[model samples]
Target: MNYAKEARDLDFAYKVRHALNESAENLPVATLDRLASARAIALSRKKQEAPAVALAFRGILAGNTGLSFQGPTSWLGKFGVVLPLLVLVMGLFGIYEYEQQQRINDLAEIDVAVLADELPPDAYLDTGFSAFLNKEEE
Candidate 1:
């Protein structure tokens, strides 16, 4: 879509330039000379355009080049990058600890339930007891 639009714009520019050239050829010599002089003056007075430069970390890190990041705010910039990573590490550690605690609590609950039951603990180890419980479920 963009390519087609660009092609149309380029075609329109070429047609306009061709029309201008055709009309300019029919103009009087004096008028052509005045236009030429005006064009030359405009070109001569035009400021030299600065080269386009891309922003890069290499430029910032190196103190001598383009824009320097070595001033008072340099530590702040480093801290900005470090702070998020510190937070992520701490968050992950916290999540891990929370999961570990949940698993321990779940095991403790199961142990307490079994201990509180009226049946002898040895009955749980009997294969017949397990079969009887399965049958009871049916």
Candidate 2:
């Protein structure tokens, strides 16, 4: 009564049955019958141990349920996952907006020569600091 040998034989039979069933369309009738018998034996053994397996899965689910958030600890607790993400997103947006504003301001203060190279001379002809000051006086 070699337990290891018996286990090996059972495992081999299970593998053969699983393979045969997977390729049932191509399998011979005799081989299908043997595979079916092997599968039945394996299923019966599994059925006998089903309760223990079910209990094990139940224990796992119970443990996981406890680990999941019970409820908000306080009003702010609801923001635990959201608060950090919101802060990160807002910070990025703020930085982008600040950089854009800075670029616009820098472009506004660019030298006339640099502006002339980028824009037509006629566009800036009547737009100068003195004109701006005259407008302020008005």
Candidate 3:
């Protein structure tokens, strides 16, 4: 019995088992199995373990830490509040602009009346060449 090879195989199996257990504690069993197989293959190919182990640890911590305990009033809930406020602000601004346009149109009509009164009496006379030609032809 070659003890060295047996020990190496046992160590590899242990690491794979550890990874699988961590994943299962966090995610579903199928995800755990997939992660375990990938890690085992990577280890068999002599790839690095630091990044993979760190990620697995983070996943386990996130799962066990209960970070999602803040019910509906989390980040998403604030948006529910802010969105309606934004819509109301936009509606008010739209109404203000419409009223402003109506006021400007009314003021324009007043300006037209003032201009008519300010012009001289001769300004209304048709003194252009077309008018002269029309009078001559008539």
Candidate 4:
């Protein structure tokens, strides 16, 4: 069935090509010249297509996968993916460092409070000290 369909398509294409060729020969020289000039102009204005990989990778930074990547701005597209990831990693590292510094500061404050207390450090080691403090709170 597929072979029959393909044969019919091929036959139709041949017929159409023959018809166009026959008609093209009968066209006026002036009309043909105009057509040739028009074809040249159209071809000149036509955009050159990039390779398959270039097309897929092009303008990806701008969320446009269809447009071709041009010369100087091509680097911008390539850097687009890496830039955001680099920034994210840097931001995360900064947040981690800030948290670590804050934790160290909190520990330092606790140490300073302990050292500045009026009670002797030995009193804190006593098992009864907690019980005495709880009783005093009552």
Best candidate, lDDT: 1
- The order of the candidates by TM-score, greatest first, is 1, 4, 3, 2
Off by over 4 Å in 3: 1-72, 117-138
In candidate 2, what residue range of length 10 has the lowest lDDT sum? 58-67
TM-score of 3: 0.33
On residues 65-97, what C-alpha lDDT tens digit does candidate 4 reach at each position?
Answer: 444464234666668767899999999999999
lDDT against true structure, model 3: 0.74
Candidate 4, lDDT over the whole model: 0.84
Off by over 4 Å in 4: 1-74
Q: Is candidate 1 or candidate 3 better by TM-score?
A: 1
lDDT of 4 at 106: 100
What's the lDDT for all of these models? Answer: 0.87, 0.73, 0.74, 0.84
Per-residue CA lDDT of model 1 for 1-138, tens digit only, reads 999999999999999999999999999999999999999999999999999998784434554433345432576666877889999999999999999999999999999999999998999999999999999999
Clash counts for all predictions? 0, 0, 0, 0
Using Cα atoms with residue i matched to residue i, what is each candidate's TM-score against the true structure?
A: 0.51, 0.30, 0.33, 0.45
